[model samples]
Every structure is written in C-alpha cells, then in structure tokens.
Target: MALEAGTVVVDAAVTQAEPSSPQARTERFAWGPVLCLWVLLTGWSLLRVPIPGVNEPHYLGKARHWWNPDWCPGDFFLDSSNPHLVYYATFGSLTQWLAFDQAAFAGRAIGLLIVALGWQRLSQSLTGRRWDGVLALPVFLTLHATGNFSGEWLVGGTESKVPAYGFLFWAIGNLLIGRLLPAGALAGLAVSFHPLVGLWGVIAGAIATAGVLLQRRRRHDLQPTETTYSLVNIAAAVGLGVLLALPGLIPALQTLEGGDPQLEHAATQLQVAERLSHHLDPMRFPKTAYWFAGSLLAIWLLLLRDFPNDSRQRWWRWFVLSAVFIAVVGIAIGFGPRPMAQMPGFGWRSSLLKFYPFRLGDLILPVAVSLAAVQAVMSWTQQPSASVSKKSLLTAGLVACVIGAISIPFPDQNPSRLSPREQEDWIAACHWLRDHTERTAQVYATDVGWAIKWFAERPEYVNYKDVPQDAKSLVEWNQRLWKIARWRIAVMADGQVTPEELADLKQQTGLYALLVGRFGPVKAKPAYANENYRVYVLP
Candidate 1:
C-alpha cells in the first residue's frame, strides 16, 4: 500500500514501482503464482491414473467417451445421456490432441491455473491491500493439500467442478471489478460446466450490480444511459451462459421420453430426476448440516470483522452479504428443508439449491479460507503501524495451523490421492477384470469405482456412482438398479450362491459376478479368487 492523499491506497499485489511502457502491462502478468499452482496440483495428481473406474471414473469415462465414442458404454447412451457435456467436450478435444491420460492430467493442471489466476484477479479486485493477490497460490494449495479426507473437491481427479470453479472465480472477480457483462458470461459458463456454483454466481452478480447502482444513485451520479448499459450487459452475460448450456439442456428436453429400448429403461434418467428432487428426509441432515454451519460461521465472522474500507472493499462487502445469505439458505436446506415449502421441481431450476445442500460447505470453504488466509498474511507483512499485527497475527496463524493439522487424520503429509490401503485392492480387481474379460462381457460389481469401466472396458450391472438424468424413467431405473445391487449384496453375504440367485446373476451380468470384500469358501463354482476378492463365473 502507498500513501495517496493521506489515505492508504492498495497496490494490487505487486510491491515494486510502477511500469511506464505498455509492454510492462503484459510483462507484469504474474507467472510465478500460476507456476506454483501448477506444480502443487500437478504433483498431487501425478500418482493418479486416467484409466477407467479410477478417480471419478464415471465422469472420466464420459470425457473419454467424447474422444472415442466406441469405448465402453459406447454411443448407445450418447443421445439420452445428460452429463456435463460442456466440461467433457472441452477435455474431449484435449484427448483428441494428446494421449488420454496426459490430456486428463493437463486438464487438472490447467484448471488449477485458471483458479489461481482468478483468485489473483479476485484479490486485486476485492481487498487489494488484504491479499495482495499473490498469496492466493499458497492459500489455495494449502486447502487442497490438506488432503481429500479433510475435503475433496467433488472428485479426486479433474472433474467438472474444477473448471466450473475456475469460471466462477473469474465471474466473481469481474463482478468485483464492475465488469458485469463478463461476470455474467463467466457465471453462465461456470453453470454450464457445473450448475451449482454458476447458479450462486447469478445471485452474486445481481447483488454486486445492485450495490454499484445504489452507490452511484446515492452520489447523485446515476445516468439513464448507465442503467440501460448495465441491463444490456446483464442480459448479454446471462445470454452467453445459456448459449453454453443450451446443448446440454436442449437434449435433455428433446429426448425426455424418446430414445432406444436401453435408453427407455436406462438408469441415467432416474439419476437426473433424483438430482432434481429438493425435499428430503430431515434425518439426513445432522452430520452434513453441522459441517456447513461451522463453515458458514467462520466466513461470516471474517467478513464482519472488516466491513468496507474502500471501493474494492465495498465490492467485497456486498459479495459477503450475498454469500452469507446463500450460506444461510444452504444451511436451512441442509439442516431442515421444509418438504412442502417449495414448489414442484424446485431442485431442477436455478433456485432450489437443496440438491446436495451439504456439499455447499465444501464449495464455500476455499473461498472463505483463501480470502481470510491471504488477508492474515498481508497483516503480518505490512508496516509496523498496521491495525492488527505481531501477536494478533501470530495467534491467528497458529490457530489456522492447528485447525488444518487436526483435520488431516494421518501423519504422512496430506496425500491428496488415495493411499495404498484403498487403492491397491481396487487396482488388483480392476486389472484382473481388464485382462480376463472380453469386451462384450458385462460384469456385476458391488459398487462401480475407479476406472473399472475404463480398464475392463465392460459395463457393470448398476453403477451407483454414475448417476444420470431422466424424467418418468428415473423411478423405474432406481428401483431396478437398487434391486440388482441389493441382490448382489445379499448373494455376497450368503457366500454360496443359491441356484435361483446364480440364475438371476447370470442373466444380469451375462456369466460373471465380480464381487469384492470378505466371503467364506463357496461350495458353488468359483472362477477365480484372491486375498481380498473373488470372481464368480456363473455357468
């Protein structure tokens, strides 16, 4: 910060003197922070394999599907599927240019860069003196580095949310900078990739825009042209997002009741419909509710402690208010959603934020913690006459360290990837299936995971994790899928499969039931056996 007219003016992260030349503007673009972001995230995902049934295999499979439609699950579900096509299409293009695995890894690395750069922009736009923008790298890396156990961002690998958040950060950053049109466009892009954050962004953009207009009006500087321009910008921004999402949404509408036989009986529709359901059993709220509540409280206090002190700060203040309102609603939805309070198909629209309300905790944590962490760093580095320094800063730092440390359950440095304990067994089973099974052979696993589909190139009977979208077909799909899953579990518990069970299993999986976990020696024919699992080849 520099003294300007007897008031401290923020320098927007760069500490050195101003650059005179136009080229300096481009040269000043900070690459170091982006490098750090890449290194940290790339290092974390290095151990991750891009094979099917690994690290959000369903989503990965979808992305890979676009690259090679002839792959597992094939072009059969192509028309009826309601996956995040925008996200997949982007990465799918990458796969066409690069090796599949490299493309996936590159996507993750680039996604982190987008987020890091967006945070820099956001910090510069918001409390410029607070974070200095540069601090966003460490703050973000630390949050992710705390490991997926403390939290995981939607999936362990490069899932849709990564890029969604990348766009979302930019949207908020633009909003803070009073670039409403771009903000709206980015917000729409975010939603197109990942609907949750993008919807929140719409609220954020509206709040920030309102705050700006109100301030201008109060100063007696409001112009009719300004209002017109603002409205036009808002429409264009939202219009851009809708255009991005049109492909995904349009298909969902067109084929809601029309498709092939498999499509008609498909589980994708059910998963989609379930996602649109807002009312839930309140009993499901307790554990997740507490997590969201705690995070909400943490962010609110951080914001309340420092109200607006400048134009940038004013932008943050309105954002903070919008954020708080969103959090409160999320908490309410998570904790005690009134089943009858909402209209029909609330979750399907933009407002019914109740779909997976608890995950909102994970969504907000990075934003809140990143802002708070960077601001704290700024306090420590600034002049001795800083408002809060030395002891205050030290205490806060220690507290953060303790909170972070306690969150990680293990002694080994927070392994963002899965440990050997979990991954090794999964690897063995998936590899065995890949090498032994025919491409045409379908298998039945307890729960589809990792890259099982990718490596095995065989569809499982019911992939619970691979939730899809639907209208009337959703109920039937869930019922049928769960029935098969339950039957598989029951047969697993029985150890020796009944003649009847064997017959049904044979029909569902063609001839093999690839079951995992402990089971006693079976009297029935066992095709293969390992320490942790067994393959039942139905005769």
Candidate 2:
C-alpha cells in the first residue's frame, strides 16, 4: 500500500495496542511534569528585568488612555490608529476592575501571558512534548534583555517584535494542526501587532499549503473531503483577518486626505540610498558564511540521504527556508541606512538594526542551542550500543552544550535595570504630577511623556515627539510657567536640553519642574534622586 506524505508507515501488526478505556486515552495527553517544567522555565524567563524597549511605554500609555473613558473626544475612529490600543484596552479594563496598577504591572502581565501561550503552541508543534516548550523560553528572555540594553541608547519600544514572534509561532503551530481558520486569524492578529511578523506567517502558510497541494498531486488522490476542509480553513483565516482589520482600514482610508510633498521627496531619496547601500556592504551579504557552514554540516550529517524517508526532513526544510528568508531581509536592511546615527552614544544602532527582518543569522543561535538540547535528550533516551559508542555521542553533546553556553552568556551582556530607588523616585514624580495637575491638563514632557501621561493621569501633549501644532498653545503655557519659576519639569537626558534651553523654557513656561537623566545636564537642583532616574522641581 502507498503511504501518504504525513502518515507514519508503522508495522501495525507488531505495534503495541492502545489502552482499552476512554480515561486511558485522555491520560495519554496529560504530561504533568513537562507542564510544570514549562511553567518554571517561563517564570525564570520573565524574572529577567523588564526590558523597556521598542514602543513598550507607548503601548502602555495607549492602554492607559483607553482605560480613561472620558478621554479621546470627537475622534472615535482615530483611536484605532494606535495598533496596540485593543490589547491595552482589554488588559487595562481588567486591571481597573481589579484596582491594580493599570500602567506598569498590568501591561507586563499581558505581555507575559501572550508569550506563554505562544511558547505552549510552539512546544506542542515541535516536540509534541509539552515540556519541550521550555526550551524556547530562553529565546524570549534573551531578546528582551538585548532590547533593554539597547533601549538605553535609542528609541527602542516603537515595535513589538518579540510579542509579534510569539503570535507568529502560535499561528504556525495551529496551521500545522490543520486548524486553518484559527491559524489565519492568529496570523492576522500577529500582523496587527507588528506587520513584519505577518511576513513569517504568510511564508509558513504558503509553504504548508503548497506542501499539501503537491502531496495531493503526486499521489493522484483527489479526496474532496480533505480538500474541502483545507479550503474552509484558508477561507476562515482570510475572513477573520478582514473582519478584525475593518475597523482600522476604514479610518485609515478616510484619513488619507493628501500627501506632503516634502515627505514624498524624503521617502524617495531614502529608498534610493537604501538600495545603493545594499550593494556596497559585503558583510551584509544575504548568506552568513558561518550559518551557511553550520547548516550544510547539519544537512550532511542528518538529512542528506534521508529526505524522502523522513517526515522530520520536510519540516526541517521548511524551517531552513524560513530562516534563510529572514536572514536575507536582515542583511538587506542592515546595510540600508544609519537613521539612528545622529543619536548620541548609540553607535550600536547598526548592529541592532540587523534584527529588523527577525535577524535571520541571530535566529540560528536559538535553533542551534535547541538542537543541542534535543540531541542530548535523544542520547539519553537511546540504549547503549557497543557498535555506536555512547561515550563519543556524550562527548559530542557536551561540546555542543559548551558552545551554546558560551553563546547564551555573550548575548546576555549589558543587561540593564533601574534600581529600586530610581523606580521609587520616578513613581513619586509621576504621582506628584497626578496630584498637582488637572485631569485634562496636557503635559509637554520630552522623553517621559508616555510614562507621565499614563502614570500621572494627565493628557500628554505628544509622545516621543515635540508637541504638534494642535497642542502648541499648551506647550507654550507650560514653557511660560517654567520661565517664571526658574525651573522646568521636563524629562531630559544628560545633554538633551541645554542650560540656555532650560532657562528659555523657564522663561517660556514660568514653571520650575524638570526631570533630568544621565543623558543631559539640568540647571535646577534635583528634588528627588533615584538609581536610574532623577526629578528636579524648579524653584
């Protein structure tokens, strides 16, 4: 009998029999120890300092805005422009109902929950051993740590790449299990969270669909029932995504009144330079010599002759293609532009930029580490063979472990955390603003607008940008207060705002309150200091 592509052609006559009871079948699926281990691993990963990077504060602020029902007047549809508003609103509502810290802890909790769910799905897909899910925990933690360190020097949290990856993984797992519609919906949600992740989902879906179609064609088996199920799944995914996106799409379409000529020119110039840079950088070659070498070795040792015989080989091929695609995108972008070069003390921008298309080469690091662990597990499972010396296999596995150990430690370099004192000081400053300012008062803070907007219960003038024209009057009013008071309550890094600017700001606002950081100097005395932050109330 000809076997199907995915089916394992086992010798059923010699195979062990299934248990005779319904309970036995149910019990087979419950792996308590594995689940426990997975939970423990997840906890360990989350405990690593909350890496505040890549639009994290913005999302938190947006969530806070959503929680305040009285806010966002006149523009109901404009609220949807913030991609994370839905996620934040949902979490914030729950936190508000429970009287929890809606700004800080609640946002982190939701992120953790999403990651955990994603990991669970990934583990189920890869090993069918729920415990193996813990293996991928390090990937999430390491990326967050890296982001935290990087955030110190640049605008880090503008994108939710980590969370996006989690959703993408979940969608892919669902797709593999033949739940097409749910997978598509999950993939759609991932895209809504971060558009780049949606690319991965598309790739995975296309691959799976193509594989299924090819299998059907080769077998000359036209099974209408199975085909119908697959088609339904695909349709469901598309339909669900469209439904969810309708809210955002409609508003976006209405908002496209006209394009700015200056912006159009700048975009065209940037695109030309981006293309040119890709050609000049040898280091930005699509294939990393090191990764290519390792992949070749893996194929030679494990998959060279076994492709047609092993189902696992097909999965491996899919993974390889995905990784390669991600790598190519990263290389292209890494060589593209030095957009963040103007920022002070952040020369490492180029290195971090490489992660844009999921950092194809960096992804190999996790895959390599996981493979080592898998090999170790397989070695432990197999019985001793006189012909195949267990000692050699054990030594090889240890060497792989050492390589992974070395790799993981290096990636953890420059882990950053705000001291408890700093946290307390920042919190106090925010609270002071909350108590002093009117609920509807718009605050024009420099860097910490999002933090203050959410934490201090005031309307932020603008987030991560200078106050727009719509709020120009509010900014001028704040400036007047600073000038009269000889103090300015502005979030500043070491040299971000000059003494002259501070003096001018004081002259402009007539108020004396300035929040300064290591990035800049402050003209006013710090009323409060923390390990990672300082607050100066202008006298």
Candidate 3:
C-alpha cells in the first residue's frame, strides 16, 4: 500500500523544492502569481469602468447607509443581529471613507487578491508542489474565459462567494495538514461571509478529514496504543470551530424560526428558471450534470484504482471524498424540496436546488482534472514504471483541457443584465433620478431598482429578495416589482405598456416616475430623455 518508488522520487523532489523553515517559507511566499491573477480577473473592475449588472448595487446599497440598512425602503435584513450587518459595517465604512462609485470594484479587487493568495497557498498544500500555484493562475482564469458562464462566473459583481471561497480554500488546506484550530477559525469566517457556499465547504471538509481517518482504520492503524493525536485533537478542533463560528451561528439560529416554510412559500411564488425543465423532466437527462460529474468521477476513480493505496498524493482521496459528499447534498437539494421554479403558463416543475448539484459537480470537475493531470504528468517524469508512460500523461492533460473548454457554456460574453453600453445608460438614468427626484420619492424601477436605491438615494417600489422576505406585503411587493417592471420593459408583450395597466400601477404603488429603457413602451412621455434612457413622470 506504499507509494510506488517512482511517485516517492517525485515527492522527494517536491520536498527539496519546497521550503520547510519559517524564514524560508516567507522567502518563497508567492507574489508574482497573485499579482498576475489579480490583474487578469479584475481588468474590467479596475482599468475599465465598473460593470454594473453583477448585483453591485444590492450589496453596495446596504453599504450606502452602514448604520441603517434599508431593505427596499421600510423593511430590514436584520430584525436584530445579522451576518450581513458586520459585512456591511466593514465594507460600508471603507466605501464612505474613500467615497467613490467604484466601491464594488475595489471590493472585488480585494476579494481577488485574497483568493490569489489563498489559492497559491492552498494549491501548494494540496498538491505538494510549489510550482503548481504558478500554473494554477492561467488554469483558473482560463476556466472563467471558457467556463459555464451562467453557473460559475457570477451574474453581477463580486458576490459573497468570491471572498467566502478565498477563506474556504485556506481553511481546507489547514484542515488537511492537521492544524485544526486555525482551520476552525478560517472556516467560521468563511461561513459568516456566505452561509451557502461556506456550509458546503464545512460539510465537504469534515468528510475529507473523516475519509482520512477511515482510510487509516481500514489499514488496521487506528489502535489506541498507537502514538496518535486522535480524540484530544478532535475535541480541540470542534471546540475552536464552534467558538469561531458563534458570530454567524448565533444570528442564523435566532432567525431560523419558520425559515423553511417561508422559503417554501417563496419558492412557490417566484418564477423558476426556464432551463430548470431539463432537470425536472426524467426524460431529459441532466446533461450538464453528467458532463462535469462524469469527468470528475472518472479521474477520481482512475487515481484510486491506479495509484498506490497509500500514495502520498492525498489530494486525490480528499477530492473524491469531498466530491461524493457534495454530490449527495446536491442530489438531496435538487430532489428533496418542493419545486422552486416552473415554466410560466406551462405544466413543468423544477426546484431551485435541481440544477445546483450539477453546478457543484461542474465547479469541482476542473480542479479535479487539473490536479490529476499535473500530478500524473509529474509522476510519469519521475517513475520508471510500466503502469504509466508519457503518452498517458499527455492524454490526461488533453482530456482535462477539453473538459474545461467544453464546460464553458458561454464563451462569447459574460453573464450580466446589461452590456457595457447599456450599463452606462442605467448609470446615467440613476444620476438623473438623483438630481431630479425628491429625497423620499419612491420610484418605479425593475431589477435596476437596487442601483436606484444606492445612486439616487431614494426608495424604489420593490426589491429582488423574495427568498428572504416573508411578510405578505413585502412578498407581494417583490412579485409586483418584477411583474410591473418587466411589463413596463415589455417582458411579455410586444414592447408596449398598456395605458390601463400603467395607470393602475401608478395609483396602487404610488410610483411617481417610470424609468424607461430605449426599447420601452412608445406611450411613455419623457420628462427626461438621454440617448440611452427616458424617464417619464406619471401623470
């Protein structure tokens, strides 16, 4: 069950290449790689104007008034203490102190920097190769350039996962090295930032750690008499984890009452993504899911079956364990809950969670393939074995690259609500509202309302958080905002806002102005019309 002599030789070389002493580690700390990745991912965020559609306003609006978070006017995200409270406090304080429209851009740059550093450190730890970090830069960026745009890359600006994953990768590296206390603390902060992704990280991490212990046990190596830090280590790890997680956990538990029912009710009310039909119908196999999951599983099993059972290349086993756990959770989420999405006016049904499992699988596939390819190639270089050859290594690399290339669901453009020009138009419209509207005026805007709330410093008729808000009034407002805004934008009909509907909305919602796009209804009388947009004050 020992590592093949050839693999052992590769490990020896890696050990010689990596630094062991504290001062040496500092010397080897990677800056060039981080700098390269930061520049690549944030070019649009930094050098060019900030791209608007990635929900920048949603988070920035919360930061707009740090001391007070206005969740679409009167409502609030925190009835008491909330996880986002601290996040807003920190980000809001910075945005106010610096005072710029590109706060989200700066925040994203900071997030990418953290990710770059964390990725460098974690990649080296996971693969036991210092150079792998340098290579991973192009690998990760290339995936985005050629990634499933809707699934992997965010729709809007840097969402919570950007920072959350930074901490998550670092935490997992620590967990694998048996440094439980730091791992616990890092994992806690990760959760505080974004519960959904962080929760998955925690679950996957625990399973990876347990998988190691299980492997040891199967080899008859878990005896109490053996020299090992077992129960004591586990206790300390759990204690630190709970202590560090208190900030996120306490507020979450406090707010957990009736949370599920609210979520269920919200799911029923919200519009399901049209693509979700592929997952709901048994006849329509989950092609996206199968493509990624299949690639990941195939490579993982290859390592397990081919590599020596006790090979020092532990990432393979860890990834397999984590992938299995993620798959199970994804399956449960996809199939367990009631349908969260549906085809409007159609009989088909799909859960919001339905495609998530596949999404997770897709995310993991690249990392798995990349890791396996690099390590296998390295193994072949060192091993004088009959089991592997140069041909096998090239084949693996080609396969991984192909999978990554194909997984890119959208290659032509990124996933955003507006193009760069349209984003400028929206920004111009927001500036107009700021200059003209009363401070307390609640305008009627669509998904662009979040931007209005921030830039215009005025309330809008609705928001897009049906998943969180349960109040009958807010829920209705949320639904109406989409229906009204989309209707005005000609979502359903031939780009026309019927006169009767517009009048009824103005009377009911007290909407003072209609912020119309260039393609909006012909009847809109422009109080202010720019090249990109037109705003009509309701008569």
TM-scores for candidates 1 onward, in order:
0.72, 0.60, 0.73
Query: How would you encode candidate 3's per-residue C-alpha lDDT over 1-539 as one tens digit per residue?
Result: 01111122212222222244321242244667667656655663333223443456566665555555443354332222343544565565556655445677667777777676666656665665665655544454445445441255422265566676777666655544445556666777776766655666665554554555455457664321222344555456556655655665565544434545665455434423322334333223446645645655676567545543332244336644575666556444444333433334222234334323443344555655555555555566666663555657555665564455434444223323567787677778878887987765667654444356656666666655312322344345556656665555553376566556667667867887777664455475677877767777776
Spell out the clash pairs found in candidate 3: 54-156, 54-157, 147-408, 272-341
10 residues in a row with least lDDT, candidate 2? 7-16
RMSD of 2: 9.7
Tell me the spans in candidate 2 whose CA falls farther than 4 Å from its real position.
1-38, 50-56, 69-80, 98-114, 128-130, 135-164, 207-233, 244-258, 264-316, 333-356, 359-376, 384-424, 440-450, 454-512, 517-539
Name the candidate, 2 or 3, with the larger TM-score value: 3
Model 1 residue 264 CA deviation (Å) reads 14
lDDT value, residue 71 of candidate 2: 52
Model 2, residue 451: displacement in angstroms? 3.8
Give the candidate order by descending lDDT: 3, 1, 2
lDDT of 1 at 329: 60
**TM value for model 3:** 0.73
**Using lDDT as the measure, which candidate wins?**
3
Between candidates 2 and 3, which one is better according to lDDT?
Answer: 3
RMSD to the hidden true structure, all candidates = 7.8, 9.7, 7.7
The model with the greatest TM-score is: 3
